[model samples]
Target chain A: MSTSEGGDSPGEAGGGPDGTGDSGGLRTTLTRTRAATALTLRRRDSLSVVTGVTVIYLLGYLWAVGDLAPGFGGYGLVLAADPLGGLLRTTSGPLSFAPVALVRAGPLAYEASLNTLVGLGLALLVGLNLGLTYLTRKQPAACGLRSSTGVLAGVPALLSGTACCGPVVLVALGLQASGVILTAFQVLLPAAVLVLVGSLVAVGRQVRPEAMAAASGSGARGSDNRE
Target chain B: MPRLTRRRTLASLASLGAAALAGCTTDANTGGGGGTVPAADDRLPLPIEPPALRDAAVSGGPGKDGIPSIDEPSFVAPAEVDFLADGDPVFGVARDGVTKAYPQSILAQHEIVNDELAGDPVSVTYCPLTGTVLGFDRGATSFGVSGRLVNDNLIMYDRATETWWPQILATAVPGPWNAEPETRSLREFRLVWTTWERWRGQHPETRVLSRDTGSPRNYARDPYGDYNPREGYYAGGAPLFPPLREDDRYGPKRVVMGARAPEGAVAFLKDGLREAGLLSGQLGDVPVLAVHDPRYDTGYVYRNPDELAYESVDEGVEGPAGITYAPDRLPLDRIHTFDAMWFAWAGFYPETDVYE
Candidate 1:
């Protein structure tokens, strides 16, 4: 009955006795993920990895969607007549919300859009995955699993930020856009979130808590024990 | 005083062009449908019916007012512009003693700019997909991008009537907001498609559209592609959308000097005009001439009913009594022409007579 937020105990979070049942495995995955994420944030090296990747990915996302780019040198701010109303409006392509404000710093201008928040969410997921990957790699005892999903999943999230005319990649690759391709483009953002979450769960479930605690020179909580 | 002199000269030329093309006008009224947007007296030839064109309209990734029009466009002196490169394309317009240049880079982001030229309201529109920049008299109302495209051209809707006006067609087409509206063409003026260096060189005192377009967009980054070096979508072989009619005579992205009237539509290959300096073509049964302007690297189409043998000379074009006139100002009646990508012109005007 304990949802993902409060249920860090392996037995309660894992629904079935075997922990391999479909529902049980998902719960176990969630419990392990929370513990692993806490460890990631608590450790200096893993936290650094998360911070660096998130910032880089966010900036790259902004640049790809063209919300951030080099501009004529000037400093100014422009707010749309109706910022709140504009937030719900889409621009350029699907899921690409209209920018409500323009902020210009010398040599650079950025359009403030809801997509930035979307990108931030994706970036955090990607960064967490990478941080988990780092923890697994740095301490072999922590987990025997390794994954490149963090990097791979980040690609679609970046492409999901299509520009005003069409998909920026399509334009760059000189590929003709068809109905099927555009439809596929529309699902990219959601697809990325699903992939990142699945990858994170897959990565987290492998982290043996007792081994991770030993690796980090910390005490393992009885609730976090998976064995 | 010199600016005033040049403005008067441009006004005179515009008047002469309108008067000369008046022969193409008839009793046909592309009705304004009681709209504030001014309707042209002559009904331009539409490839398809108004309702059908409306049916063919497809969403270009935005909704009404999605690609916001610069309602209160601000401009700066050419010297104050640092965002534009020398070769960046700019749409230069001169009317009522005012000269202004709208950079393609900036307009690429915002398709429509509702601004004033010497107290007269006008909309400067650019379609990145079709590579067309058109200027229309807005009358008392302004225009906005409908975020819908027909034949890969920007569909502008008037604020007053909300009727769809495709940039290439310049004619009213029924839209979702106001179906069954009048089928009328707009009063269009020429927006010279020239490079920033060329436009600035010709009009030294010209006001350049500043990066201070109230809406915050990365003006330096063209979502469609680059124009100065011609890359990405601008240089692509295939159009983003299928054309209404397909003609393989020229590449889809090839730029052509296109002019249409009630009589018919005609196009001259821009490169061919540049090379030959002068080319003759036909709009339906009437004879027309395309004179290349070396100053701005643009072409002007004129109605030459007499088949006048005017040759391109160093001064401009030599005509009656061997006196030379500017390429933009020939003795013959001028047809309102603007540059368009070949596919757009052919798609919108399938019967167009092309001079390559």
Candidate 2:
């Protein structure tokens, strides 16, 4: 959780309660990290591409599998893995960028797919958060890291984890979270999703298309490792 | 960190609200009624110390019908259930000469199978949590999960009256019939858990419940963790929720065969039956007999022939021709009996006798 929302909604956002009022620190860290990312935030190849992919993924995932539990059947998310769970499956094998819409994914299928999608989103955010923070520290002011919103942007990923992963996390923390907390963890995803969208837009705003074009064309390409 | 604080207090209060809301969600999702469901009320007439001790049901989680029940279930002949391994458990009921077997694999998901046997409408109810399979005469009505639990036992509701009936107690409580003379306990029948091979062999004409239950279900995939060898959730001592009455005389999860008489109830350890083969005992003033059928690996209770009102009719092969079974075959006048977890049986009927 970014320190921004901790005080307002303790368990709604992220991190420990003691971390409240650290938004300024979070901002300081985000700015410092965003400044170093080699991939320009708004570049046709960087944040823009990621934003487009994320948007498309969300739309397609919901379109195909959303009906299984419209608004999650008022349960937020479910994790169905029964083989008789009909069409939507996410437990085994590699996943496609988009899930195939089935006539009906049954009750269990809806739960399994939601868990998979949310779980995968969390993993990606963690990786992006770590990789971006590293670049900011390594080459300050050189890459998009200083202006990148990935760290704050990825805070919503905790909501995704909270949806299906709250119990495991809380159990690990040795905290006997109430059902309400567990439910809130999943219930708050829509709000977290909204926060995520805003962060993506902010990240996209920082992309300097011109700088990205120049870096790509000139010998400066040596300075930017695309992969 | 003092174990209580404003944040903690607010959080606890919020959680309580959530639990109540969860009950509402269960009510909404299950479509059983139009009002909010009280989370854990178990004030049934029982001998337990705490008549209704319970935990608040946490919601925003699986609600009633959230896991779903097999209301529109379909069945198959013996051939379709060829997948049954030797060790698998099945609940078999023979009535009016026609016999049917319900695999635990199927029961593991949908705990209630409302079907007719020998033309008699019955609800074959199983609660994996308590390890009980009880047959109830629906009396032309149907039963669904009330989405409530008493001592972690399945609380069921009849569609007609919407009265909540805890499966173990088998009586209506806290519903429209709360003040009624006697809690309407459903008339139970003989339901034995045995091997599929033995059930099919005893009555090869037996129709096994099918996986094609009109809904997409992993008929083979078990929702509750594996209990076949008791190496999963069944292997542990933890219970989802404790029953109101607390007793440790029998392990909470130990399987015990129980029978109730007009006077009181009694239980026999499965091992006791496995060893004794045949044991005669008295429940109330009436004498009862407990026998172990090694072929099916189950214990059966019946009224002792000496005290039986009449002789159990003998039918050569099938049963008494029509939909009624020949009571004389096993010669145990079959009564509504269940094999339940020791803790659950003892929790509800603390006055029950246990055969060592």
Candidate 3:
């Protein structure tokens, strides 16, 4: 029943230089910390790349929808209003050209602020992925969470797509592009909210199960061995 | 990692500053009323020879008093008089040792004419602004009488009526008595007679008349019909016209004649014109004869209301000071319709013997 034979073998302990119990314990702790840090870093890096790519994709969708649709359709009011909506709009229909389209619509001031905010949101998503990836590194079954996180990250961009669709269209057709930037900001707001939620969940999981259990269990075992 | 470089930041700031400065500079003459200039060629054509008087003998000579004079000749029919479309002809009068003439033709066009003649202060006055003519006699103690021409059709007051007339045209208004008359007094009428007198005194080359020996009257009754001499006749009534408001009276009175003054009167007019931007740099050095007398009441005649009112003082008063009449009464402010007055001195040229 004990993990010492197979599940908790010497190799599983991530072997240390000295064979003493204290040394093994210390080595195990160090290896776990390093593994967690590496996993977090890798997840963060991937998330950053994914978020950045998503922004670029959203921009394309905004551009295309704005160019093709008439009136306020290009502004994508629905996408801008909700995070999921923005992501959906970006991924859906022939309106995939929003991002690139917004750039051509006007000068830098119109889009720079909203784009910066979006870029920040995407960065946060990368951070979240790093945390989640670090937590599940030892368990392959939990690896599926990465794809779900990615999908969730896309929701904001989709919502931004819908909300900004109308103004984006106007900007594409030689109208004021500032409207699109403004609408995009509204759409991306929900993404910020979601990122906050993800951060809280990650912190709770880290402290509640892993850190508390390890601290109490180690304390009791030490007393028993001494007795 | 390296910090951002200062060189790039400075270059960006400089470009922005340059762009802002460029937006402020604009052309001055790009808009509104200043763009258009009036055409100078809008004057009537001049006539060659003015018409002659039918009864030349009676109206031609000077009276027994030695001043060049015009008698009350019968009013000729409008057809008999060859009216020039633009101007009236010059008339002649021989009196005393001098013979002087007035060119109504030129006077009609200019309305106000100035000149010097025959060693005497004379002016052939007409107010083109109000279409009134009077003879100013400066020889009689600097106060003249109203001359009678064509059976009193043209009356110029002499020393007798100096105190009662308002010289400025704008000051004249038609009152209850002589309000609705067909004729109105010209504000600048004094200039015509004064110009004639100046010509006579400066240039004896035209000796039309010697100084008259008869004593000039200080006051006289109104001779024109329906114009009462007593009941508020002359300036004895309320000011025939209202005082000029401070805002409307832009500048001080200009002395275009007589002695030169370093300040006071001259400075007053100069300051006014300068503020208006109408001063032409330097003042003209012509010696203008400034007569600050109240005898000339330059007024207008209004047809609707029957009254003799003074011209408003809004425009500087000019003309023989004693005559009275009004033009029209405006509705909004209840102000009198005022006109311009021409006051000048006329004299005869002995060599040419005609009033030029």
Candidate structures ordered by lDDT, highest first: 1, 2, 3
| C-alpha RMSD between model 1 and the true structure | 7.6
Q: Could you give candidate 3's per-residue lDDT for residues A1-227 as a string of tens digits?
A: 11122223222233433324866755554544444333333343333544555456545543333332122112211122233323322311122211221211112111222333444444455444434443333232322122244345445544444443333233223232243444454445455546534542432222212232232232223332111
Q: Model 1, A92-169: lDDT tens per residue? A: 676788888988898888989897998898889888988888777766544555455555666665565453335445
Cα deviation in Å at residue B246, candidate 3? 64
**Selected candidate, larger TM-score, 1 vs 3:** 1
True-vs-predicted CA distance for residue B85, candidate 1, Å: 3.0
| Full-model lDDT for every candidate | 0.78, 0.52, 0.26
| Candidate 2 lDDT over residue span A1-227, tens digit each | 02232232211221223234568445533442344243544233444444554554444333332223322011222222343453433211112111222232333333233444654464444443434433333333333435445566666655353443333234234343454665565555556666554554344233332333343433234534332
Docking band of candidate 2: incorrect
Assess candidate 2 and give its lDDT: 0.52
What does candidate 1's lDDT look like per residue over B149-186, in tens digits? 89988999987778889988888788998787766678
In candidate 2, stretches whose alpha carbon ends up further than 4 angstroms from where it belongs are: A1-227, B1-61, B175-182, B280-287, B303-334
DockQ: the better of candidates 1 and 2: 1
Worst 10 residues of 3 chain B by lDDT: B347-356
- CA RMSD of each candidate after superposition: 7.6, 13.3, 38.0
Would candidate 1 be rated incorrect, acceptable, medium or high by CAPRI criteria?
acceptable
Identify the leading candidate in terms of TM-score. Answer: 1
